[model samples]
Target: MRSCSGWRRFLLCFSLLLIIFHIFSVFEFHPNSVIEIAPKKRNKKSDHLVLGPAAGQGLPNRLQCQGSKALNKSHFLTPSNASNVGDSISFVTVFTIYSTSLDSHADDKSSNLVTVGNVSYTKKERSMAILNVFINFIEVTMPQSNVIILADPESDLSLQRNKVTLYPIQGEYNRDKLMLQRIRSYIAFLNTRLKELAQNPGHTSHYIFTDSDIAVVDDLEHIFQKFPNFHLALTFRNNREQPLNSGFIAVRGTPESILRAKIFLQDVLEVYTLKYTNASRMLGDHLALAWVIKSQPNFDLRRFSKAQAFIEEIDGASVLFLPCATYNWTPPEGAGQFRGMPLDVKVVHFKGSRKRLMLESWNFFSSASDISDMLCLILMSGRTRYDF
Candidate 1:
C-alpha cells in the first residue's frame, strides 16, 4: 500500500513540473504578451507645440468638429481643398500703399503714384500695376493659389486673371486717415470675405493679407505650409513679445479667429482715431492685434523669430514666428545684413523709408543675387553716400 501511494505522488509531482515548464516555454517564445508597457514620459522642456494627434484621431469633441477633419486627413490644407472645408490657404492684399516719397528721380517713375507729390493712382491703374508685378512672379511659381485684391471703390481696379479677384469698396475712404482708415477698410473687407467664404462651400478658409509694399522674389507656399494650427501668423518689426505687424497678416477662416480679428480692428481704430489720430504717426493693425494678444489669452497666435526665417531648414517649425528675412525681409531691419551676404530673401517688405521707394528697394534686394549686387555696389560707393 505504501509503494502504491508513493508511485501516485511521484506521478502527480511529474505532471506539476511539466505544467510549470510549459508555462515558462510559452513566456520565453512570447515575452511581450504578458508585459504591459507604459508610454515614454513627455519632456517638459520640449519646444514642439504638440498639437495632439491631429483632428480626427480620437480627439476631444470640440476639436473633432471644428472644420479640422479635412486638415486631419491630408495634413495639407491648401487652396484646392481649403474651400470645401471652409478654410483659407491663399494669398490676399489690400494694396493701398500710397507713396509719400517726394523724389523726382524715383525708380518706379512709370506710375504717377510712385513719384513724389503725385501720390495718387486711379483705382484701375493701381490694381493693374500691383497685379502686373504680383502675377508675373506667381505664374512662374507653380501651385499658384488665388489672389484677392481689396481696393477703394472709385478706384474700381478690375482686371481678369486666372487667379486674381478684385473687390471695390463702397464707402468714401478718407485717404488722409492712412493707417487707421486702412485698418478699418481691411477689417471690414476681411470680415465680409470670411462670412462669404464660410457660407460658400468651394473656397479656401485661409488668407495671407500682405501690404502692397511686400515684394515676393520666391515661392511662398512653403511659408504657408509651416503652421497649420495657428489662428494667425505674423512677424514683429519692433517688439517680439507682442508682434503687431499688420504689413504681413495671415488670417484663418475660423469664426473664433475672425471674431478676434474684428476685436483687434476695432481696437486699432480706437487707438489710431480716438487717441492717436495722427496719420503720419505710424499706427497700424499690427499693434491692435498685439494688444489683443497681450490682453486676451485665448488666441492660438504664432509669432516667428526674425533669425529663423533666413535659416534654410528650421528644426522645430511649430514655433516659427515668420520666415523673417526669407518671407518678410526689410533691408534696414537687418534682413540683408548678414556678413554683407543676403540670404534667399523671398519677400522684401518696404516699411519706413523703404515704402517710399518700393521699386528701388525691391530691385536692389529682390533675391540673394540682387542683394549681393547691392552689397557690391555699396562697397564700391563711398561711406559718405549711405551714412547721411
Candidate 2:
C-alpha cells in the first residue's frame, strides 16, 4: 500500500512538471514570435482628423473575417496580414524656410536684385508671388485643405493671412559656417514641434518639409488619407550622379520619423564639423538635407522611389506638387526670353540669375488676357459656369 501511494505521488509530480514546461515553450521569447504576439493596439487617443477606418479594427467582410478568425486561433497578428487592420488616417503639415544671403551679386548680373530695386522689394515681390501661387494652387489643387507653414519670425506679416498657419523661428544673421549650424539648429526646433504634436495627440498625423521657394502646383488631397505606413516621400533627380533635392519631403509623424530625423541631424552636424571645420565652405540648406537623407535608411532611392511628377502620389490617396513659379523658377538671363513651356513642370526651381525678370514675366502671364482670360472665358461660355 505504501509503495503504491509513493508511485502515485511520483506520477503526479512528473505530470505537473510537464505542464509547466509546455506553458514555457508556448510563451518562449522567439524573435520571430515577438512580432506575432498580441496585436499592437492602436493609440485611440491619437488625433483622428479624417475618419476612414479605425485602427486595429478589421473590416467586416468575408476575407477579413476569415483572417481575423485565423489571427484569433493563432493568438497573434501576422505582420503580413496586419497592414489592412492598422491605422490609415493621417494629417498634413508644411514647413517652409527662407534664409538670408550676404553676397547678393555673387551669382550673376541679371539675378533678381538688379531688377527688383532693393532686397526688400525683391523679398516682398517674391513673397507675393508665392502667396498668389499658393492661393491658386489650393483653389485648383486642394480646395479644401488645411496646412501649417513654418517660417522665420522676420518673415513678412502679410504672408500670414488666410488659411496658412505660420510658425516662426528666431532669425540669425551669421552667414558663414554658422549658416550650416543654423540649419542643424532648425532640426532641434522641428523636433520640438513634432514632440509637442506628439504630446498633444490632436496634432497632425503627417508632416511635409518644403522649402519656401517651392510651391504646390497640383492637387494633393490623396496624401493625407494614407498614413503611418508610407514612412518617407521625396523627389530625386533623374541624373544618378546628382543626389536627391530635398526641396519637398513628406513623412508620417510616427515615432520612427521623429527619432530618425534627430539622429540624422546629429550625424550631419558631425560630418560638417569634420569636413568644413569653418564657415568658409558655404554649404546651403539643400546640401545639409541631402547629407541627412543620404545617410538615412528610409530616404534612400530604394525605399522612397521618385515619382515622375513633382507631384507625389502617396499610396494612391494623396498628391503633392510644387506650388507656383514664384516659389520655384529660374529667371531668364540677359536677352533670354522666358519661354513658358509646360513640361511636367509642377514646381519651377529658379536656379538662374533672372529672378526679378522672371517675376515680371510671371506677373505678365498671370494677368494676361490669354491664359487666365481664356480660362475665364471658357468657364463663362460653358453651359456649366464655374465660380473662381
Candidate 3:
C-alpha cells in the first residue's frame, strides 16, 4: 500500500509538470528555451523602452514591411557578386570587431571576434557574446540586406552565410597603435566602396558603420530614406562636453557626400595617427571629432529641431544629426533615460556592463516565433505583464 501511494504521487507530479509546460507553450517558445516571467505585472520602470515607432513622431519614412516582399536574390548584393558591373544595392551595414581591446596586453590569448554558431547567453559580460547576439539577431531579421565585418587579423569565424562578407584589419596589436590602425581600416574600407561606386556609377549604396556592442531591435533599412539628401548621418548626445558618438554613422556614396565624409575621416585619421600615442595620450577620438567638426570647410547648421533631426551642410554634403534617444538606445543617456525600449529605437548600444540586459531582451524576443503586438508580450502569463 505504501509503494502504491509512492507511485501515485510520482504520477501526480509528472502530470503537474506537463500541465505547466502546456501553459507556457502558448508563448511559442523554443523547446528547452528558458523563460523567467515575473510573478507581478509588467514593470512600468522597464516598459519605458518600447519596440517599433510611435505615430505622429515625424518619422515619415518608417519600416514598411506589410505588403512588400523581401528583396529578391538579384537585389541582395554580396561581395561574391558585388562587382557585377552596374549592380545596385539598397544599403550595407558594417560591423567592426577585433581581437585587440582598448587595453592590448590581454589579447594574446583572448579574442573578441564572434559569430552566430558560437554565441551563448551565459557569457553576458563577454564582448564576443555581445557581438554574437548582435549578428544572430541581424542574420535572422535583415535577410534583405548585405552585412560585412571589418574583421581583425586573427579571426576564425567561418560562418558560411551569403549575407556576410569579411574584410581584413591587419597589423600589430596595442592600445594606441590599434586605435590608429582601426581609423585607417575604416578609411580604406569606405574608400574601396567609393572606388567601386566610381567604377560602376550604378553601384551605389549607403554604408552604415556600427560598433560591435550595438543590438538591432528592429529593421533598420528605412533609416537612410528617413533623412533624404543626407550624405552623412551622425548620432549625437545632449551633453555638450562630449557631443559626438561615432558608434553609429551613415555615409552616402555621392561624389560630394564622399568628399565631405572623406575630409572628416581623414582629419580623424590624422588626429589618432599623429597625436594620441601610448607615450603621450593627448587627443582621444571623441575630442578629436569635437575639434574636427570645427575645422576648415566648417559644417553650417541648417536645421536643429527636436522633432526632426539637426541638419548640417559642408559644401552640400547634407550631414544629418540624429539624437541618441531614437536611434542608438543606450542606458540613461537619451532613450536610456526612459523606462522601456522606445518604439523609435532601431538599435541598442550595449556598452559598459549593460550586455546582460541585451541578452535578456534577445531571449525574450527570439523565444516567440512571431510577436506582432506588444500586448502579446504583456499578456504573457495569465494576463500578467512581464519586463526584463
- TM-scores, one per candidate: 0.53, 0.47, 0.60
lDDT of 1 by residue, 185-253 (tens): 667877786677678745455667777656555555555465555555655543554455667766666
Q: Between prediction 1 and prediction 3, which has the larger TM-score? A: 3
Kindly provide the TM-score of model 3 when superposed on the true structure, using C-alpha atoms: 0.60
Q: Candidate 3 on 264-305: residue-level lDDT in tens?
A: 778776765565454222236656665566553655423322
Model 2 lDDT tens row, 87-195: 2322222222243342334345343432322223344345455545444444333444445654445554455445566656554424354445354544655587577
Return the candidate ranking by TM-score, descending: 3, 1, 2
Quote the lDDT for 243 in model 2.
45
**In candidate 2, which residue ranges exceed 4 Å CA deviation?**
1-140, 146-160, 171-174, 177-182, 203-205, 223-228, 239-241, 276-345, 352-354, 357-365, 368-388
Considering summed lDDT, which 10 consecutive residues are worst modelled in model 3? 65-74
- The TM-score obtained by model 2 is 0.47
The clash count for each model shown is 14, 17, 10
Instruction: Let me know the TM-score candidate 1 reaches against the reference structure.
Output: 0.53
lDDT of 1 at 336: 26
